[model samples]
Target: MIPAQFDYVAPGTVADAVAALIDGGEDAKVLAGGQSLIPVLRLRLSYPSLLVDLRKIDELRGVREDGAELVIGAMTRHADVISDPLVRQHAALLAEAAATVADPAVRHRGTFGGSLAHADPAGDLPAVAVALGAQLVAEGPGGRRSIAAADFFQDYLQTALAPDEVLVEVRLPKLQGRWGVAYEKFSRTAQAWAIVGVAAAVRRDNGAIAEARIGLTNMGSTPVRAGAVEAALAGASAEAGTIAEAAAHAADGTHAPSDLSGGSDYREHLARVLTRRAVTTAAGL
Candidate 1:
């Protein structure tokens, strides 16, 4: 299937990209890696009048450290994210999750920001981002603004980014204490989207669980924070039994969707099961 014809522009800078998007109006679509959008275009799911390509913007393609956080450019490839020393050291959970995204070929072409901006609930990275409390940065005619990962994703396949705003980078705070992080996912196949996934980070103090963060994938319209489980684990024992008890609350707030892959109840069950495994591993129990 051939996509409908559209005007195209490769912007050298974010400013130019915003201008191009503004000029193209609501009919303009930003092209990052084109891993997601091109397929939509080919299937005629979207018919934009213009395509604003950001590949020419070199500044939006690297990882760097800024004080206490690691700043990842929006255009950084998944493969790069997985191998970047800075990402591996400061945000290993992100690298671990990136390793499970599709295969090597897609990893080389899929952009980090593009995946988050796509906001697929089943995507591994969004759940990691939410679990890490990462910040998403965007640029538009209104200048720049920072959005928390919790607020950045609004719904399935939807984000807080305005049509004219281009995601610039993501800021992940370096884990400061004795924190162990893990991502666990269940899919039909290696390349298939996760039916249920869990991202867990646990900080242990004196053999007790001081704090925990858990994010759910494919559990709701947006990546869901397991706040109930987090609260349950706070100041609790870092033992398998305690972690399993907290994991039981994984489905407490989720609105799991029923699809061809599995039913909502089945996903909820997977959530509890995977949460136990992920949290146990993260807790080093």
Candidate 2:
């Protein structure tokens, strides 16, 4: 498959890119890693009049610590995220989840912000972002603004980023104390999209679970927080039985889909089982 004719520009500056996007209007599309958009273009699913490339923008590529938060530039590669010591040390769940995105080649080419902006519910990063309560930074004609992870994804293949906006960076809160984290992904094969994925970050206090944050992938139209499971786990014993009992509520508020991998009911069941594993592992129980 081949894409239709389109004008392309690789802007060296964020302002220039935004200007191009504003000029191109509704027919313009921004190109980041191209892992998702290229496929769409080749299939002729989208025919943008202009494509704004952001790869050469130096400011949009790196990982650094800002006060208590770790700021990751939008253009940082998944491979970089996996290897960056700052990310590995401060936000282990993100690194662990990024490692599961496609295979090595995709990880090498895919950008962190690209995946989040693509807003694919099955994508590994979105659930992790939601789980970690990450903040997405977007720059548009109106300067800049931050969107909370819980409010970023609007629906399947949709996000809260406006058409004129480009996601610039992601701010992740540092894990404070006694925190254990794990990502549990269930796929038909290695590198395949997860049928059901769970990202868990649990804080332990004494011999019980102090607080737990759980994010679900492919459980709804968007990556969703497992609020029911989290509520059930608060102050619960770290025993396997207690964790398993709480994990049974993983699907309590989700609206999973029926796809080739499994039926909706099957996904709900996997959510329960995987949630237990993720929570238990993250709790170090």
Candidate 1 lDDT over residue span 249-269, tens digit each: 999978999999999999999
Cα lDDT tens digits for candidate 2, 1-285: 999999999999999999999999989999999998999999999999999999989999999999999999999999999999999889999999999999999899999999999999899999999999999999999999999999999999999998899999999999988999999999999999999999999999999999999999999989999999999999998999999999999999899999899999999999999999999899986
Per-model TM against the reference: 0.98, 0.98
Q: lDDT value for candidate 1?
A: 0.95
Q: Scored by CA lDDT, what does every candidate get?
A: 0.95, 0.95
Give the CA lDDT, 0 to 100, for residue 64 in model 1.
98
Model 2: clashing residue pairs?
none
- The true-structure Cα RMSD of candidate 1 reads 0.8
Which ranges of candidate 1 are over 4 A from the true structure? Answer: none
lDDT of 1 at 42: 99
In angstroms, how far off is 267's CA in candidate 1?
A: 0.6
